[model samples]
Target: MNKKLFLLLLTVCAFQFSFAQKNLLTDFPKGYTPEEVGKRLAYRFLEGKHMLHGGKWISYPETFNWNGALQFAAKTNDKELVKLLQDRFEPLFSTEKALLPIKNHVDLNMFGSLPLTLYQITKEKRYYELGMPYADTQWEVPEQAKPAQKDWSKKGYSWQTRLWIDDMYMITIVQTQAFKVTRELKYLDRAAKEMVLYLDELQRPNGLFYHAPDVPFYWGRGNGWMAAGMTELLRCLPKDHQDRPRIMQGYQTMMKSLKNYQMPGGMWNQLIDEKDYWAETSGSAMFTYAFITGVKHGWLDAKEYAPAARKAWMALVSYINDKGDVTEVCVGTNKKNDKQYYYDRPRHVGDYHGQAPYLWCTSALLEKDTK
Candidate 1:
């Protein structure tokens, strides 16, 4: 072909390829499959907050948001976003303790997830090394004092004095990742042991795990943490390990119970069982990530669970505004035991906690079935 004709064809092909790539907020037909729409909406929400926690040029960084950005970049191959997160947060590493001083479960738990991502991206042993102290802190919990025990008072730390399902992922997922990097049996052993402890202490008779066993309430986001944690653990754990089946059962139970709680709009309420509770986007997004990742990894039956995952995704997508901003995410909270506490919780737009799940949801959806 002549040079001009060849160049024209190449340009047309490039345009078509770009158009075919799926993102956080592309419009689709009405009544499209829930998974398809959910995936699209999730991606749209994620894209909107690409530079979260930073000013137009300068940004303050938090551990959790940076962790999510790492996952999003890995999945989507958005190198610029990854570098942006690393550059902003790398300084924070200097002051980081093996365990964070923050009292909140989610905030402190973030330490476990961040270092592995840094290690993965930078191939720096220091990141992995930094994670070891946190892993050591997490793994050091006495067997008798594991979160599954009904008595929180027996635990040494003030923060860990109770059984919260969210802690399983927050603590164990990172330990497992550390094990992968360090190849230490203790990390793996401790992660598996802690997971069993949480499951034993926290699993409800209804098959869903409770938000906090010590408290009377069950929150959707707490369960989402459990589900996501299990999915992440399963991804890293050995295929032939003895705990695999038990772990799978935990995931299956969560998937089964959560489906009935899904709202018609494709979201789960703050109080998952209480229809009166407002639909929560962060929990819904986390569930979508867990379920979709479960399906991708062959832990959950795709045919049965994918629809529910898709519905949650779609409902979450509706929260994204035109500016690529994700809205209606429930803000960070410490464990609250009362129904009123969860119900009364205020929702915010583009909070850091919400950003992680937004990216996770989008990346998971894009991986499975990109339009």
Candidate 2:
């Protein structure tokens, strides 16, 4: 072969080899295993102990980070890590009433799942014991409460009577966990009913659920929460339950629409509809986790969804920097009016928000059952 042609072929092969290594579905990269990635994130949480904001730390929406750490600990079986979680988390319990101070449905959902995770790891009833009252109260919210109105508080947040896809994760998944812990059929029943309500009320004509009905936004991460939440809820829900089919149908409908929005690079943008929307990493990671988990657990068809999951995983890995930090995560936002509102959101690299989903997606993708 001519020297020029030989060099060109070598370059092409090298590029393909490099790409394959970075692609999580095709091959596991040498430097960062799922466990290592998870540990690094856990370490960050440890270092930032007091600085971590949200339910487990401060009472912020992003406090959902604790759930991510708990997931990593359970999957990796790192007892010391689990102990650290218990230490940090136990203090957050409200001693006055002996109940978690979950003021809103969203916090109730995020922190509510933690006790169940603690129970899973330690099998200690105390972890889940405190959550009982709150779990019981959640069932009391009328199945048909008018959708929440969208009125931003002084802190640039809004609430509405209607369900948003985000609430599925923020609330329903935790409710499902509570059901699993207590084995109370009511918890599952209420979760299923609420999930169906969101599906019925918020799902757009295009098959994707709107981010918020009152706000009329359809952000990708918002939908990611719904997809992941449903997958988690389904894992614990009974197979023969009547509500199972409805939930599955909702997932299938959303997956169909998601397939169309996937970019050539694999990541979805903040605004999934606009071609110019820059691909986002956090939402992409969550979607990949939910889709891959669904396929593995038989909730979704592997042959059909795996390709999309793989593509999103590949794009997600590309966002990881040399230091093993995941980047380009879109910042948290309230409901918005137009595509530009989503597109203009700032992006950050190596944020804990992004790291959680990265760990989740990698773990889900690399699971032997999925392959």
Candidate 3:
């Protein structure tokens, strides 16, 4: 072949390969870009006066939004956004200390994730001092723990282990945040071990999880918790980590199941396996987050998963109202055995449960984000 022709052919081949590799971040339409969507969501989160629905102390949904907003701020290097979020935490030092959650339950302890994120960005000692204890206490066995809880603790699990699907994200995020900042192996190890056990006990043969064993319903956000939890864990879990294989397997399995259920409009149903159920925003966003992270990290096949992720993102953006609140989010729910309990849950607009995961998906889509 002629030298010039050969060089041109190689250049064309390289270009084709580059296009073949899915870019989950860009190729978005106006108002749906990660930067725009993330800023809108972060500012909206900061502007809100209250995140706790009626609880005296801040709960997981609110903390989850705070943590995600902080990450978005840090990723975008939005100094103003970071400062605003940090200032919100100021009252916990004194005036609103009572509003701070206690270290007893997984949901409460997960509040540590927000301050720890602030610590990572600002290197502030106050945030570190307040946050580390919550992560640590999660592993510390309590005297009042039941026999089964005691057995879980004997094997180094938290006494708070209730085998609920929601517990995985609540348990995983705080520990993952600790590990990310402290470079501590114990936090990662504990989360990984707990994740593996959850996979064994709760993950059904179909790769979807029941809200709990007795519930036997694949509630979307319940599975969303497991999906997002595994994605967060795998992001930090080392390639050679002992539990990596099992965690990866569970993540992949759930993702495949999730992929099959993604609607043509890219939203997932409130009951993931029930096509007749309503399209849900929070769970849909959460699943999109997992898909985006998995594709970005090379844990999932990019060509197949990236489009699904992109479609979900675009579809989620359509759900956001003029006020930046995510629509059709299922209200905070507890596990009930009856399928009707899940089907009948009210969907709210702008609920923190719905708003939180959108920032997560946006952050995952940012090209420069290596975290």
Name the best candidate (by TM-score): 3
- Against the hidden true structure, what lDDT does model 2 obtain? 0.68
Candidate 2 or 3, higher TM-score?
Answer: 3
Ranking by TM-score: 3, 2, 1
Better of 1 and 3 by lDDT: 3
**Candidate 2 wrongly placed segments (more than 4 Å):** 1-26, 49-63, 93-100, 141-161, 322-324, 366-371
- Tell me how many clashing residue pairs each candidate has: 5, 9, 0
What is candidate 3's lDDT per residue for 24-123, written digit by digit as tens?
4567878999999999998999878666535688878889888889889988989999999989889999999988888888888998998898899999
User: Compared with the true structure, what per-residue lDDT tens digits does model 1 show for residues 138-239?
Assistant: 534445554553243243222353467767767666677777777877666666666777888889877677677656676887887888778778777787
Candidate 2 per-residue lDDT, tens place, 1-371, comes to 99999999999998886455335354546544566566776666666634233424343333456667777777777788888888877666554233345445554435556677678778888877755655555544444444443231221222322366777876676677777777888778767777887888888878776777666666878888888878777877788988999998888788778878888887787777767777877777877888778766766666567677776765676677766667888877778767677878888866666777776765565465622
Q: Return whichever of 2 and 3 wins on lDDT.
A: 3
Give stretches of model 3 more than 4 Å off: 1-17, 368-371
